[model samples]
Target: MKMKLIDRFGKRLLYGSVLTALSAVLSVYVYAQDGKAGIQEANDKVRGYFSVGCDLMYAVGAILGLIGAVRVYQKWSNGHPDTGSTAAAWFGSCVFLVIVATVLRSFFGIQQ
Candidate 1:
C-alpha cells in the first residue's frame, strides 16, 4: 500500500539520521585528547633536550675557534697585512656563538 511505503521510508530516514549523529559523536570522543597533557608533554620534551642543544652549540663554537686559530696562524706566518683584522673577526665570531648560547640557555631557564 502507498501508506505503508511512506511509513517505511520515514522510519528509514529517521534511523539513518540518528545513526549518522551517533557516529559523529563517537568519532569526536575517540579523537579527542587532553590538551593540557599534550602541551606538558611537548614542554617536557623541549626542556629535556635543552641541555644537549646548549652543549652542541658550545661544541660548534669550540670547533670554530680552533679553525679560526689555524687560519690566523697561517695568515700571520705568511705576513698578511690583514692578519690582525682577520684574527679579531674570527675571535668575535667564536665569542658571539658562546654568548648567544649562554643567553638562550639562561633566558629559557634551562638547567646545566
Candidate 2:
C-alpha cells in the first residue's frame, strides 16, 4: 500500500521532534553537571573534562543537524520519498535540541 504524502510528512515530523527533545534533555543534564562542578578541586579531578566533551558533542550534532535539515528540505520540496527525509529530519532535530539544551544550561549557569 502506498502511503499518502500527509502521512509521510507527519511521520517524519514526529520522529524529528522526538529526537530533538531527547537531545535537549541530554544537553541539559550535561550542562547542569558541569555547572555544578564550576572551577574547583573536584572540577580539576574531573579535569574539566565534560565541558570539552560537551563542546565537541554540540559541534558534531550541529553539523549533523544542518545537514539533515538541508536534506529534509530538499526531499520535501521535490516530493521525494519519506524514508530518507524522515531520517534526516530526525537527526537534525536531535542535534538541534542538544545544542539548544547545551546553550540554555551554559547561559543559565545550570552546569555544576
Candidate 3:
C-alpha cells in the first residue's frame, strides 16, 4: 500500500520529538556538569551575539516542532493528512541544532 500523508507526518513528528527530547536532556546534563562553563567560553571565543540569538531561535523551533507533532497526531486520528509535517520537521531540525549549541555552550563555557 502507498504511504499516507498522515503516516509520513507522524513519522516526521516522532523523529522530531525524539531529537528534541535528546537535545533537551543533553543540554541539562552538560549544564549540571559545568554550570554553563562551556557556554561562557564559547561566547568569549566567538566575540559575538549570534550564539545567544541562535539559542533563542532553536528554542522556538522546538516549540514549533511540538505543535506540529500535535497537529500531525490530530490529523492522523481523524484520518486526515497533516499539511504541516514538512514545516514540523524543519523546525525540529532547528530545535536539534539549538540543543546542540546549548550543550556546546555549556561544555565550552560560551554563555558564562
Candidate 4:
C-alpha cells in the first residue's frame, strides 16, 4: 500500500511539473513576439482573463460561504461536538478564497 501510494504521488508530481514547464515555455514564446502590437495583444488577453477569473472567484466564494453557513447552523442546532471545528474550517476557506481573489486582482494591477 505504501509503495503504491508513493508511486502514485511521484507520477502525479512528475505530470504536474511537466505541465507547468510546458505552460511556462509556451507563455515565454508568446511574450517574445516582436512589436508593440504583439505585447499589447498579450496584455489585453491576460487582463481579460484575470478579470473573468476574479469574478468567478467572487461567485464561488459567495456560494461556498452560504453553504458553510447553512452547514454550521445545522450542526449547531444538532449539538454536534465537532461543530466548532467544522464551522472554523468552512469560514476559513471562504475568507481565504476572498482574500486570494482580492490579492490576485491587486497584484495584477487590475483597475475596477
Best by lDDT: 1
Q: Please, what are the lDDT tens digits per residue for candidate 2 over residues 1-112?
A: 3578889999999999999999999998887786655656675755466566667677777777777777778777898778585875678677676877587557745564
Write the candidate numbers in order of decreasing TM-score.
1, 4, 2, 3
Stretch of 10 with least lDDT, candidate 2: 39-48
Better of 1 and 4 by lDDT: 1
Candidate 1 clash pair list: none
Give me candidate 3's TM-score against the actual structure.
0.35
Q: What would the per-residue lDDT of candidate 4 be over residues 1-112, giving only the tens digit for each residue? A: 9999999999999999999999999998887776588878889999989988998998999999999999999999999999999999999998999999999999989977
Which model, 1 or 3, shows the larger TM-score? 1
Candidate number with greatest TM-score: 1
- TM-scores for every candidate against the unseen true structure: 0.69, 0.39, 0.35, 0.64
Per-residue lDDT of model 1, residues 45-100, tens digit only: 99999999989989999999999999999999999999999999999998998999
> Which has the better TM-score: candidate 2, or candidate 4?
4
lDDT of each: 0.94, 0.73, 0.73, 0.92
Worst window of 10 by summed lDDT in candidate 1: 29-38
Candidate 4 segments exceeding 4 Å error: 1-40
Show model 3 residue runs off by greater than 4 Å.
1-46, 82-112
Candidates 2 and 3 compared: the better one by TM-score is 2
Tens-digit per-residue lDDT, 1-112, candidate 3: 3569889999999999999999999998877797578778886667576566666767787777777777767777777654466556756676687777677767655553
